[model samples]
Target: MNASTAWRVPSPAEIPGLSYDALVEHLRLSKVNVGHYQSVVSALQEELAKRSPTNAYRCTKCGHTEYQVGAIRTARSGWSSFFGVETAQYHAIICAHCKYTEFYQGKVPPGQQALDFLFGS
Candidate 1:
């Protein structure tokens, strides 16, 4: 993607008199939704924590815990946008013992989250 298509922080020269409100307005217009991005990251983290092989899944039916693999859709259903891009999906393992399913939507990468958390809105 080009610079404009990707996330960027404008240089001071780009907007010498930029105020907080102005900056926020620019972000909104540019489709830079920070909360949305954070939500996706949080979802992925929760999924990762549960899907770790060492994590045990308790079967609702048998009360047994086991390890298994699973998949989750990242796309938000019934959601539309002017941009045609859809969210990515990530699949992992759940518990085999209980037939439990762990689904992770909004598959934001851990590296991306680390960058965002350390550097941005």
Candidate 2:
């Protein structure tokens, strides 16, 4: 087979019912390099570093001030959704001894402002 035959692009006519959003979602889920996902992530990291919110929690033993950002996991045990499925619930924790800080997971609810800025929404 020739190079063109080996690397043929799929046409919408061949792929019956693929909507633009669906195709975009497929590309995103497949981790395709359609856009600068890394750049977005980097910008997010920078924003997180700059505007990390801290919760004050005193250690029961040492009594040190701890700065922490909430944490979250992308996947979980069992949850259902119309499109795909619910991933996981976000959570937060604090350091007991040294009162170290943690990375920001996503958002803190009623705080879409940060997301709007990050995504330009």
State each model's CA lDDT, in order: 0.47, 0.41
The candidate maximizing lDDT is 1
lDDT of 1: 0.47
Number of the top TM-score candidate: 1
What TM-score would each prediction reach against the true structure?
0.29, 0.25
lDDT of 2 at 98: 70
lDDT of 1 by residue, 1-121 (tens): 2456345444435443444334444445445566544434343334445544446556555666765665543333444112222345565646566566655343555565445445542
